[model samples]
Target: MTTKTSDSPLPWPPAAEQLPPHLRLMGIAAAKWVVQPVYVLAKLGAADHLAEEELSTAALADRLKVRCDPLRRCLRAAASVGIFRETEQDHWALTDTADHLRTDAQMSLRDFTVLLGEAPMWAPFGHIMDVMRQDTPAFDAVHGQPMYAHLAEDDELARTYHGAWSSLTEGVMRALTTAYDFSRFATIADLGGGDGTALRILLATHPQLRGILMDLSHSGEIHQGADRAFEERLRTVSGRLPDDVPPGADAYFLKNTLHCLSPDLVLQTLRRIRSEMTRPEQRLLIVEGVVQQGNGFDWSKLMDIEVMVNNGGREHSLEEWRTLLSQSGFRLTSAREVLHPQWLLEAEAA
Candidate 1:
């Protein structure tokens, strides 16, 4: 799962040079469109087919029930960005990127992209200017309700949103498990570990460790644990982070969960972890993309705007995380970049 830095990410355009400032201003909002083909590909089970062979456009069209020209156009667009590759002029093959879209990949981001480009997810971008003017969730302005509430009651929306979130997190989970040492802890509770995938890896890697996932009662509906080698060592508790965390657990993993919450919500969740920790060895492991504004436009910084539009959440810089961690009585002990935009951040009770 661990790759050299080259595989971690393409080092440049430097990331910023990928687009001009003005283009970025718009592309930042428009980039959700990039997730569309991924969703379509996943729905068509394109990767599943590619697992067997590179497909000719006609074969893909036959499998997907779409016309060849449309399928070819989509393949062309995806391949241009390296999401898929052309094995020959009219044939397409899956890339490493395809792994993330598979249902059973080590770290699947398939579900995540489904929600990213859906109307509700993309609708918020239209209100960013008003959000800047009014200082409110543009989502509420556009949808007449909060994003979560709207999705919570709508099965289809919830499914798509969670799918998109899962897609965004697939690589993160892969990058995190292979890049860190989790053997010292006997028990770890992922405060918002959706399907217990992280727990699955940790349990497999650390046989003595048993990991619990604490999330909403309905979390299983959207983020069910997979039947895997280490699944027996994993368990799920049906509740929110503040209520579901077990007392005296050795570690709490909050991966990408904080990026969608406001600072107050984050503080409250961190406080819950604090209340559960009394032993010196207890800790919190946060995997997120730290914002490095003015210096970089790495994906994380760009994602800050996406969060802002979608949830009113802002990406935190390393300093921001350090301050927040300390505020919750935790001290950051180490930091490592796990992927191109993500960092494996470790903190212990202060």
Candidate 2:
């Protein structure tokens, strides 16, 4: 929900107090471009196609089956944000932002773009009103099913939706890998770990350690692993939590997944993990973006709204996470805010 600023005033629109007739009368129309152009280019696979070669507006429009004029404007807007580059004579190429969308790029976010634009993803916005009116999750109104069920039922959505986390969590994964030593934990369960992206990183570090990716059984091999030994230590398990924690798993990892639920629900998730702790030394490490206090962030605030509409959820303050874990009978063993700013909290069975 933390949106990229594209000439749009993010903190919110200015007060309509006073304005010259031309500008004031138009009033806050700038915010609309941020919403429209992003979806347009995202759907076009603009970056994916451009990865091979720069394309002129006419060619890009032809590839996407659209008219040239509006497409040119969309491309220009994205270029202003440095997502795409206007090379010369209207041709466009990829920048770091566009690099994320390529099919074979070291870092690809095609899935993220696809998920963000899909109806299951966008439909929640339509019911934001209902969420405000009834103080509940808007997903049911949007999909006629629980969010989890909807994700499970629609494979395309489930894959793309889950991959958005892959794109977003890559930063946190680096923070975690850099901040902690994984060699200590003999066995780990990456709870709700979609494609085992985190496990891939941890296994490579620990060498002797083994990991269980407990979520979608079909989270296809994340491309060809660069490290074969690490790939061997990692195993995929299709199932829910508690049951999914493989035998002898002394370590549990639940990232980004925790803050999406209410405190009571978090308690249940913790209790389930606690039930699987075979030894007193077993621990649960959760990585999530904590809702920081004091300074306000557009990401946290807008994500707060996103969670509310999608799951009746919100990111937690560190204290809120601690309380949630404590209520579920876990003791906070250590807490670290990774240098990247996304906080990682580790807890142990009390």
Candidate 3:
């Protein structure tokens, strides 16, 4: 996550680089079709089976429990987009992007891709028009239950859901820890921190920092090894947000939690946290994809639509975040874009 930033100047898009409106429109429509093969490859563990070597389609098919003909087609489709490389006529190997799809690979997106490909998750997008009309979550309309509730009832589904989220937390934490200093605080509380991945990273990085991981419950859901490693300092507390949070922590970390709530709920949650603060020095650090305002396309814009459709959540702009914090009796003191599409919004008692 400690990537280099370009200081050299670069020219803007030249006139020759611009495409015709029709071709651009076609490219946009084709994106949906392109993601299918990538998702299929990740779900089937095809990249993992490749073993970092160019394997014939038949061999890969045997490993994946699929027919050779269709399996070859799938690998070829992914190769076309540079996910995998076709070394020979029927032999394929993982590319740099496809390498990350391997099950055991570091920073793997395989689980996240599988979760996204699940029927319940993507089916809601089909009724996107209706979701926009109703102004309610499409997932709830399609499944007759909220997303988290549906996951909780099924153990396997819940693991997959949490795994997908944890996979993302690793990268985000790396970037954040590098960009900001958490050593100033002796105790840090992670509200709704799924699996305690972020807190584990923080505690490991800052040895002096004691931690608290609070969520709906601390059943078999959290990583036991992480707890045992820092058992003396890291406490797993079960509680709901807004209505409850551990008081007296020097700082409260709410990474990717606020964007899951509506405006009113967010305000209520922040106000509740504000009441818990015993000192003006206590901080609230919210890490999320703060929507950037512009006419051009960006990832947060797309994420905003997805969050709205799936969870009735909206990714807020910086101004909106400031307003929300102000309304909750906290002042937005600092805003830093530690990573692209993700910003660290810091607030203190107003």
Candidate of highest lDDT: 3
lDDT per prediction?
0.72, 0.72, 0.80
Tens digit per residue, CA lDDT, model 2, 1-350: 11222332322233345455556445456654554575678767777677677778999899989999999898877666556778669887776666777655565677776676677778788767787678568887767877877887888788777677776676677767878877788888888887777887677666778888877555645535456676677777677643445566878888877656766677787887777775887888988767767765546556777777887778887788888888888988888788444677888888
Structural similarity to truth (TM-score) of each candidate: 0.77, 0.82, 0.91
Give the poorly placed runs of model 1, Cα more than 4 Å off: 1-42, 50-58, 79-109, 154-179, 220-232, 241-244
TM-score of 3: 0.91
| Candidate 3 structure quality by residue, lDDT tens digits, 131-214 | 758878999999999877777677776777777878678888888999998878999989888788889889888889998888
Error of 3 at 158 (Å): 2.2
Task: Assess the local accuracy of residue 260 in candidate 2 as a C-alpha lDDT between 0 and 100.
Answer: 68
What is the model-wide C-alpha lDDT for candidate 3?
A: 0.80
Residues 1-350, candidate 1: write the lDDT tens digits: 32211123432222557667776667555554555765677767777677667779899889878888877777776665567677656877767876666676666766665566567777787778988887678888899887666876788876666556555565566667678877788888887776555566566657899877877666654334456645566667777644456676788888877887878878888887888888888878988888776863488877888877777777898999999989999999998888878888999889
Candidate 2 accuracy as TM-score: 0.82
- What is the overall TM-score of model 1 with all chains considered together? 0.77
Of the candidates shown, which would achieve the greatest TM-score relative to the real structure? Answer: 3
RMSD of each: 5.2, 5.0, 4.5
Candidate 2 has its poorest 10 consecutive residues by lDDT at 1-10
